[model samples]
Target: MGMQPMEWTENALIKRSTDFGKLCALHERDPEAASAKLETMMQTVRTMLEHVGVADVNNVEQASIITEILTKKFRAMHDREPETTEETNLIRSFAQIHARVQQAHAALQRQNGDKDTSNKSPNAPHDNAVPPAA
Candidate 1:
């Protein structure tokens, strides 16, 4: 028999609330604090997956991943009297990832002339975001 696949990512993120949707909601409610934490966790996952030669975040998935939690973090950065450089950079990286993913999808569509490439997109830079201590 083949080895069983390990699926620890979702479990690694387990919180008081085990529901993914509810956990996301809780994070969104405090993006200023939670976004950085979430981003760090996610980037680590991405790195580990890439190391194992299985990192594939397509355009649709990228779009879905940038949920209210991320946008609220972006907004929080902008709401400051003077947005910190670090905050601006983090939000801007998200925007750039979104744009590049969209562009890759469009290019792939044109190249294949209606043939689906599974809507795959270019990988975004795997830089980490560090939130300043409160």
Candidate 2:
């Protein structure tokens, strides 16, 4: 069944990634044309990332997560034998980008998580106040 409108989700992204098989078939039929199309597609995705200000100061973590999700989807789609160096690099680049995003996301989550828990920590300034006389 077709997905309902505005129903985009991580699962939906993962499911859509399987459509890469069409690109693979095209590559088999017309390697030169497929290469050009793939390059254009990659450039378009990079442009979209730039438009969203990914890996930038504003909304850093969220943007990084979005980049990571896209990288993951691309990685899943291309996790197969590569016929050329360019194809191999494409896979490698996505994996590398995904790793970097995952690391950055984890660091940000940890940093934010610590701030959230600090106030409630037993050793926090307010929590360490001396008891009042009864």
Candidate 3:
């Protein structure tokens, strides 16, 4: 058999989820702060893209392109082998921010989904709901 995947402790996962929730709360309370953080990240990515050029860059095409680039750069810089304390902390912070932003986005998506679901007609049939098929 192949090796089993490593398991995370329940407490660890709960702590992480809680931290992500807190980040979501922060985003909700002051979206400007999140926007500033993202803008800073985008500025960093733009600087890197200028350095490397768009042709040389592999992954900078998505909405979260800046976050993706920063995460990649951060990992490449620090996660070679054993990590120093500073490197570990940097990675942790980077990961937390990323996770928090993603969680906030997920929360937004869920809210949007709920709104859409609530707005839909309960009696509508799937195929005949809208105008005739073209």
Leading candidate by TM-score: 2
Flag regions of model 2 displaced more than 4 Å: 1-16, 51-83, 110-113, 116-134
Q: CA lDDT of each candidate?
A: 0.45, 0.52, 0.44
| Candidate 3 collision pairs | none
Greater lDDT among 1 and 3 belongs to 1
Cα lDDT for residue 20, model 2? 47
Worst 10 residues of 1 by lDDT: 123-132
Tens digits of lDDT, candidate 3, 8-80 = 3456444434444444355557866855654554444344333332232132223134444445654554448
Give the per-residue lDDT of model 2 (tens digit) for 4-39: 322235564454344344565687689888778767
Scored against the true structure, residue 118 in model 2 reaches a CA lDDT of 36
Ranking by TM-score: 2, 1, 3
lDDT of 1 by residue, 10-68 (tens): 33334311333343555558865666665664464344333323133342343334432
Tell me the lDDT of model 2 at 59.
43
RMSD of 2: 12.0
Clashes of each: 0, 0, 0
Error of 3 at 75 (Å): 2.5
Tell me which of candidates 1 and 2 scores higher on lDDT: 2
Residue pairs with backbone overlap in model 2: none
